[model samples]
Target: MSSPSANASEVLIVSARNGPIAKLTRDEAEQLFLGRRTTLSDGTPVALIDLPAGPVRDRFYLLLTGKNPIQTRAYWSRQVFTGRAQPPREAPSAEQAGNWIATTPGAIGYLPADHADSRLQALLPLR
Candidate 1:
């Protein structure tokens, strides 16, 4: 029953427990999520995962990029049409996104605070 305007203050950007990334600034996270950057400042390639098109996904994009779901869709459409980049792989839900991030090396994704657990290393708090 989430909505695009759901309170996202509890969202967290996360990675695998052993991921090379220890932390990320909001600018770096925004760049990575928007497909503007592929590697961390230290050059570790990032495998970004995203939640499927939904309230959580929309809320994340809105908070991270200040773009609504429709705007984000258009942005990605252009990126794809221009061959600039593909959007991150989509997970079925926040819990699944967290699971993937925890098990995949160099993987990063955002999840609701409750879903983030010991398997994942939280890099940044969206709020």
Candidate 2:
């Protein structure tokens, strides 16, 4: 298990590899995570993965989009209802998300900073 303070403090937006994507601004990170942007700046299509619901997920949205979990859920619901976009695929745990990010090309996901490793490239750090 992880500590609440640690989970709340930092989130790392990561990709499968470095160089392919060096970094992203907060706005770009938010857009990509929210399904508003389907590709990276270099035109590479990305698949967004999400951690299962918890403090980390809640903090991620709050920091990135200024929305709480409920608001974020409603936003995605509206998008799906209107046929605009789909929410990110959910990973059961940070380790699983890391594994997916490591193997899937153009994959992106957020994990507690403590969980980050060489398998993925850190693209953005959200508080």
Candidate 3:
């Protein structure tokens, strides 16, 4: 089936090639990105990186949460205002996001599929 996003951009959940995780479920991914999760099923801790505000970032959240950027922003605002959680650390660009994933141990993030490379391992694809 097609994704709920308007564009349905191909995005991949990724970690450093040698990172502890090998894969993740959609529910697991959602929880992690939303800051409600920090460890994988195997108990390996993870950090989340994010692409700066743009089409790719918007598309990623839309595919993951079925929420547009505005809605997602509001959700995060509330999360922060209430001190419940913090959003992921955003990189200046996709390249930077990928680099952070590659060098930062246990760092996990989403990238446009075409931007991922050998240094990273695909954990899941949000189609």
Candidate 4:
């Protein structure tokens, strides 16, 4: 059997400085990330990190696009190849991803719930 998944999933919404103070519903996160619409009221692209390929990502996959992370990578790669938009930065782990997003401007990434720190905001509670 596959290994247990990460600690938790937290969807954080970031702003210029002080945000993701606002929490997000699972559905809202679904639209933002998988939609890749980049035209939300805040007008920033949603960012997702390299989550382990397992049940946690699976649940998110179903919630978002009904596709796996690999599929999402392919979709973003195609977009990048065509110069339409850029894919979200890929981090090795949740902490690394959080560090990147927390420092970068106009960035939003999902991190495992317990891992959420002052650097990153927690959006949704673990179920």
What is the TM-score of each predicted model, taking all chains together? 0.88, 0.87, 0.89, 0.58
lDDT of each: 0.81, 0.81, 0.84, 0.54
The residue pairs found clashing in candidate 1 are none
Which scores higher on TM-score, 3 or 4? 3
Q: How far is candidate 4 from the true structure (C-alpha RMSD, Å)?
A: 6.1
Of 1 and 4, the candidate ahead on TM-score is 1
Off by over 4 Å in 2: 1-8
Off by over 4 Å in 4: 1-17, 20-32, 44-59, 125-127
User: Model 1: runs farther than 4 Å from truth?
Assistant: 1-9
Question: How would you encode candidate 3's per-residue C-alpha lDDT over 73-126 as one tens digit per residue?
Answer: 998898878888877988998999989999998899988777888899888787
lDDT minimum window of 10 residues, candidate 4: 1-10
Which pairs of residues collide in model 3?
A: none
Candidate 4: tens digits of C-alpha lDDT, residues 1-127: 0114325453233322364324455665655565445544565444545455565555555555677667876876787787776555557766676677677665666554555666565555433
TM-score result, candidate 3: 0.89
TM-score of 1: 0.88
Q: What local lDDT score does residue 74 receive in model 4, on the 0 to 100 scale?
A: 82
Model 1 lDDT-worst window of ten: 1-10
What residue runs in model 3 are displaced by over 4 Å at the alpha carbon?
Answer: 1-8
- lDDT for 77 (candidate 2): 92
Order the numbered candidates by TM-score, best leading.
Answer: 3, 1, 2, 4
Clashing pairs in 2: none
Model 2 over residues 85-126: C-alpha lDDT tens digits?
878889999899989888877788888889887777778778
